[model samples]
Structures are given as structure tokens and as C-alpha cells.
Target: MKRIAVVGASLAGVRAAQELRAQGYDGGIVLIGSEAHLPYDRPPLSKAFLAGTVSAASLELLDAGDLASLALDFRLGVRATAVEPAARRVLLSDGGSVHADGVVIATGGRARTVPGWSGVHTLRTVDDALALRAALVPGVRVVVIGAGFIGAEVASTCRSLGLDVTVLEALDAPMAPVLGPALAAVCARLHLDHGTDLRCGVSVTAVGPAGVHLADGSLVPADVVVAGIGMTPATEWLAGSGLTVSVGVCVDTGLVTSLPNVVAVGDVARYGGRRHEHWTNASEQAPVAVANLLAGRTSRTYSPSGYVWSDQYSGRLQLAGHPSPADTFSVVDGELSSSSFAAVWQRNGETVGVFALNNAKLFNRLRRPLRRPAVV
Candidate 1:
């Protein structure tokens, strides 16, 4: 029987397998994951799970029964050493090789850790978040490095737990590069309103075992320090695998790799015409590769429109289409003081994206038209 080896066992890989079976490819599907735990929801890891509102068991993306019913051969805690595309196989770290008619590299990305602050922790995986959660006890002073999405969410979760939290962002604003200054400032304020001491434009030149040491030479003491620096895709083991492994394993519009019978997806994939690290994009991109692999249906293509959102305070910030710095801008609504309504971002007279704050109705109304953009 033909075999499909999905490396990375993350959202992209897991979704790929589920879609493959749904599309009727029941051969032999093996899921390779470095983490010992079964795939679970990463987004919630910083939210409800960390807040103690949701149990770790409930954070599971798939239960044992679901995996058993799918009948997938899960290779958890095993890493793929190399992918021999010509040979249509993947060599594992354990010296075992899995022959594959097609391979999906969805290894995802790892959270980038900061130097010093050796005592600091990050939240990327279940284990990472679990350890971080333990340090977020009530009344404990938690110093968080980096105010990115993960950091912001961690800060939000900590605040919800009635813990004293302080966030340090090296950038001028939280999500500075992504949301631009205008909206990013509002995000920073939201954190501050929620009892989080957000320090923007602050660089952590060196973190100490005691806490985070700032560029200004002030020592921020805390019971524990959680770093949300960032993440790098898991592609070290894929080096020289005859695949374009730059920042991410580059894939084409169809999510196909340079080598035949091999493809990549998720955070590890730089797919479409450009790289999209968003999870929804990963989920949408995986099926295209899966369809080509099992059913011999290879006509599908993928266009990357990066869309990512965040739940900060009482708002839901959603972005559809890619809006660049030079892109045109217009606000449909900006009633953020009440934390409701939406903001429309335009580029070249086209609606490139819409960011909403507790405005799902407006978000939905803007999505279809935005997704179906036409050159006028």
C-alpha cells in the first residue's frame, strides 16, 4: 500500500491527514511529531488553558478515539532527519525510513528563545505554555519579554488570573510591524487598561537569571519571566533535503516543493506566491497538496492571502488580505474606546483587509468582497 509521511504533526499536518481521509485516501498515513503529546490547540494554550478556565485535557485537538478512528500511524516524539524526494522516502532520526508516495512537511515553527534570562520561559507548545502557566500564579510578579501575539495573549491570560504582569516590547509598539503604529498603539493601551504594565520601545539588551535586564540598565524583578520573543520554523532537519529551506521550506502556489512527491505546509512553509505563516492559510493550503498526493488530483492551486486575528481584551482583531505599509488606508469604523466595530484597510482603491474589534458582523460582511478582489 502507498504510504504518506507527514512530518511535523502540527495544525497543517493534522489537517492534511484529516482532509486526506475525508477525500477518501485511506492507504497508510503516518504522522511524525517531535512532541510526545498528541496535537492540541496552540491558540488556546495562551488563552483559556493558561487562564485555568479550560483544562489541558479539553485543549486536545484530537482525542484517542478520533485518532483510532482515523487509523493513522502516529510517530510521536520522532523527528525526521531528512527527506529523500528522489527516493520518495523520509529518513527518521531513529535510523528508520518511511517510504512515501508523497511527503508533507508541516513541522511548523519553534518559539525563538532569548539569551540570558535563562530562567525565562516561552509559550509555543503545550509543554511550553504549561510551564509558563505554572509561573503565572495569582499575585506573582510575572515579567513577560516581547509583546507579540503570544506575549500579549500570555499577558492577557495572566491578568485574567489576577496576577501582576509586566510586558516588555523591544519595538516601539506591540505588533508594531504587523498592525502599523496607529492600531498597534490602541493594542498597547488595551493591555494597559487590563492591568498589564506594558513597556514599549524598551529593549532587553540582556536578560538575567533574576529577571529581564533592560537596555536602560534597570532590572525588572519578577517571580518568573516568560519570553515570547518569536518563533522560527522547524526546518533544521530538512537541510540539504533538495528543498528550498530558507526562512521556511518554500513551496509553490500549489503548496508543492521543488522535489517530486514532496510538499510542505504550515508555519514551516513559505507557500503561495509569498510566505504566509498564518494557521488558517496553512489549513487552506494543505488540502491542495493532499488532493494532489492521494487521489492523483493535481489540478488545484493556492493563492496566499495572509489572514490572522487576535482576541485582545473584549475585541476581536481580524485581518483579511495583505495590506502593506504603502497600501491605502481607510477606517470603516474605529470605536475602539468601547471596544466594538471594524476598521477597513484599503490599498490601490481595493479593500485589502478589515480589522475588527468585537465586530464579527462587520468582519463577515467585509470578508467575501475583500477575498474576491478584482482589478478595476
Candidate 2:
């Protein structure tokens, strides 16, 4: 490939560009981004950044020195209008086009929002975090919708700021879709112990300037409303591109799309009918996507063992590998009551995943074992 275009310019896009250079591909690299600022980490936006413990400049993935060394044609604050596969060119919102031998789609995703709720807020970028943080002063009545990772972290940060924080969830327990009811129930205790008003198994009818109205006719008073519900892939621009897009851009095992010399990565790429919306997945997929692009075949297949972590209170909760609802879980070390422990998840008498709380050493050790094939 003589020239390459990488869309999104986030972690995956930047990493793909770096890998292409590291592999001795001295082609012209163009990194296009929708956001105005340089690529930054999103994980910290809901935690340290929102808490004011970290500065905005600290989130950047590439510094001046790093950008200078990469020699990338960085295009910031521009959107990709469409992809012309036959022409092998990308249409931009500014009536411009980029002709390249290969293209990497890493547009990532945007925060899902509630309709007609102009009074609420959602965090998906550094700018969003800054705006939300400004409203999170002490004594502010904050109502956070959805008890997922984003919601939990926002609630934790709000509590630290002495804000009256309340978390609402439609499910019976927090993160039940990923951790199951039993584990989610245990995790929900973290918010309760930290002085958060966590209400589960409740539906929100509407959200106005006044507060959150529940289906039961109860209202949760709030000075500020934050929505951490979920996110949808930024794939609207791909409409009529002749690519199979469901919840995200559909890709094969090699992360290659239906279009020739084109591949998708990060939260935007849905492989094997699954979307792994975590940092580790994006970092791992970028290199493989780069390899496939250069080799002109499925030289590598992306398989994630699944790793995710959350910060709540003084505890660091981590999970590795795929833990399904049918998996059997048992305490391997420490105690849940004491807030420091490790749990092993097994399927058909074979280890498949591990969950740890404030136990990094054990968590790291168990991760490798989960990657091995199940012993029948």
C-alpha cells in the first residue's frame, strides 16, 4: 500500500498508524478525526478527570514529540461523509476526498441518549467530561441514569465531591447483563456503602428540568442529570455503503469488511456477532487489522479473552475472559465481605474466566490460564 487513510484518530486509529510505521510501511498516512483535539484516553474521563485529580492535557495519547516522529497528516475536527469502495476514496464532510490504497474505519461510538431529555447530560469525550464536571459541585442534587460502568464511576466521583448522588437502573442489580445478578448485587453494595442512593428495578418515565419521573409516579429531585445508559456505534455515516452493519460495522475474523482493502476496528467493528467495547480489545485488534491490510489475506484472526476493570470507592474490580451466565463461580482467594478477593468462573468443570476485587496480583495470574483450551 502506497497511501493509507485511518478514520476516527482515537486510540485504535493512532495505534494502527503506529503499527503500520513500525512494520516498515513508509507510506503516506492520513489520520482523520471528528473531534477537534488530539486523541485522548476515554477511560479516565469518568474517573480521575471528572474528579479533578487529572488534567485535560494528561489524556492525550500522542504528545508533540510523538506526533512529530510519526509524520502523520493529522486532520482534526472533520467527519467522514461516506466511503466509495469502487473509487477507493473517502468522502469528507468538507467536500474533500482522500484517495488511498487502504482505509481503516475506527470511528468508535457515541453515548446513547434519552429522547426529549435536553436537561440531561452524557459523557463520551473529554469535552463532555469537562462540562459535566463543572456542574458537579458540592450540595448539588445529582441523579445519574443507568448503573453501568460510566454511571457507577460518575456516582463515585459525585459522592467524593459531597453531592447528593442517586443512581437509577431498570434491571434488578447493577451491571447484571455482564456480571449476572448475584455478582451485580454484590457490586451494587459498593455504591450503597459510599452513601449513594441506588435504586434498582425501577423505570424512568421521563426526565425534565425538575427531576427524573419514575413509572410509579415518584420523582427523584435533581439539580443535574447524567445519563450513562450505553453507547451506539458511529455508523450512520456508513449508510448505503454496501457493508453489512447491524449494531456496528460487521467484520470477518480478520476485521475486514465487505469492501476491499478496508477494515474496521475498536468499538465500531463487530466481529463474530459481538462487540467488545473495552480498551484491551481495541489495542489488540489494531495490530491484527494492520497485518491483514499489508498481507492481503487473513494472516491474523482477532480473538479477545475479554478483560475489563472498574474503580469504585477504594476497590479495583477486574474481570478477565468470557464469563457467561451458565458458568460456575467460586471464591478462589480472599473474601467478598472484606472487599478484597478473587473468584474463578468455570464452564463444564473447566476454568473460563476470573473476577477480582482489589487483587491485581491474583487477577493477572489467572488471566493466562483462562486463555487455554477447556479440558474436557
Candidate 3:
């Protein structure tokens, strides 16, 4: 009970160490991460950092001085190979072992790389942003291979530099899966309005030195391409760990795995209480996991309510709650393409999900005091 080891070394791991210290724990804390760099915010790698407006040095989660004061040993560039529950230790790929009273898995996720698109780059870290930012020059022809949050922001960054940008989406519309088909159309229109050549429902048949060849035999000429097709959780190392492993590391409300003294967090954690693919969930889960681990208890509970937000040019998007299976929705405010608006998703006469697009004030107003009733 005098020492704890936290794996994954991203937002969740960093927060977990901080929370343990805050919970009045005076023990040896170790944060293990596969990345050589310390925990850094991943969102801006596609936006501000790609536009050359932000620097990597500003993205660090904990400074060296903070690390020193916290008395935390950061095991950077170390990949955890296995979880030895019986021994209360972590086996690392680099032939090392970390013994601890508790372990937290905050391994985060990985960006899905596109094959045959050697010209395309995916942004998920400081290095990715730096490499992509180096190509952001005025009048450079660029093609973004998806129109999700990362792709949209990359296009935004390119547009700022007066680059000839084209966004190709295989889906009928961008952000439709999350924002609905109608509102996603609004986002499409915004891209076109800002001089982005958005081509949806088209697949990249080939990627090579010349340009991207389309399935319809059309060629889109570009000097560079960027793909942002989302990510897969970094939990493959736990393949033999004997815990639940779907697309993510399955965890419960207490953030516990079936394995004893172990918890998972961040995007890599699929909490059984609810979905947790959001920063808000990470903000909530880390402290809870740390508290339970420090207290040496097994019955503490915490729920992961999936919520995340995005900014596209002048527009702001906020998802406040989880959507229900039988959810029907109505736009309680402005039109999809117009000014401030909100979409209220309801299930059996109760609000289940709330989304505000360009409606910051209303979003803030409803950000608190709303909870989803458990589904039967």
C-alpha cells in the first residue's frame, strides 16, 4: 500500500497520479507510458499546432519540477507487456518489472493509419503535428482523407494558410453519425462556404505519387494528404491479461477489471457503467479510480457518461448526455444551418441526449444538472 504503478502515461495516467497525491497518499508513484514524451493534449495536434500557431512545448501535462515534487517516477518509452495480479507487478517489454500495491491502465488509443497513402499523414501526437505543420504553406495543394473532427480541423488549419484543400469523405455527410444526417449537412455547407472542396460519397481507389484516384476514375490532384479515421484503443498488450478486451479495455463503474487491483481509464477504457470515449469521462474516472485504489477498497462505483465537444471554424459543438436506444429527437431551437441551436434527444418523454451547435450559452446552461436514467 506504499507504492502504486499507473500505466498508459496519457491524460488518465497523469490525472490518476495527481489524484492519488491529492487524496493524501504519500507513496512512491510510477507512471508508465509507451510514448517517450510525457502526457500531452492530443486535440490541438490537428488544429492550432498544425496551423503553426501552437508549439509542442506548451502541450506537456506535467513539468519536470512538478514530477520532482510529486516524487513520481515516469517510465517513459516503456511498453507494458503483462499484468501479474498474483505478484502485484507489471511486466514491461523492456525487461523490467514495477511492483506496486495498485495499477491503473490509461494507455489511451492509436490513430488508424491508412494504407497505400504514403503521402498522407495522421495527426495523433506532437511529432505528427510538427510534421504536418511543416507542410502548411500558402498555396500548397492538400487533400484531407476524412471529415471527422481531426480532418475538419486539419482542413481548417490548411484553409488558414490559403492552401487549396479538398476533403474526401466516404460517408454521405460529415459528422452525421454523431450529429445526425441533417446537421452534418450544415457542416458540409460550412466547408464549401469556406472554399474547401468537400467531396463526399467518394472512395479513394488508389493513393500514389501522382494524386488520389477515385473509385469513379476521377483524379484529385494534391501534393499531400492527411487521414483522420479515428483510432483503436491501445490495449493489445493486455491480450493475454485475461480481462475483457473488445474494441477497448472493458471496465466497470469502480474502474476495476476482473483482475484484482487493476483499473483502466481514458479512451482505452470501456467502462461497463456507461461509454467513456470522452475527455469529460476521463476527467471524472481518473480521480474515482485513484480514490478506490488508495483506499484499498473494491466496491466503490463511478460511471462513465460519454461526452465530447468540437470547434469547426466559427461553430461550436457540444454533446451533453448519452443517447438512448429508442431516442427520438427534436430541434428545440434554431435551424441546422442557422445561428445558435440545440437538438434534444428524448427516450419515452425524458431527455437522454442534448447537443448544442453554435449555442455556447445554452450549452453552458444545460451542461450541469442533467442525468440519464438507466435504460432497461
TM-score of each: 0.93, 0.97, 0.91
lDDT of 1 at 337: 62
Each candidate: what lDDT? 0.78, 0.88, 0.79
Question: Mind giving the per-residue lDDT tens digits that candidate 1 earns over 241-280?
Answer: 7788788888766677776577777888785444666778
Residue 127 of model 2 has an lDDT of: 90
Point out where model 3 deviates above 4 Å: 63-65, 273-275, 295-298, 324-326, 371-376
Per-residue lDDT value at 141 in model 3: 91
Point out the worst 10-residue segment of candidate 2 by lDDT.
367-376
Candidate 2 regions exceeding 4 Å error are 372-376
lDDT of 1: 0.78
Error of 2 at 287 (Å): 0.9
**RMSD of model 2 against the true structure:** 2.2
Candidate 2 TM-score over all chains jointly: 0.97
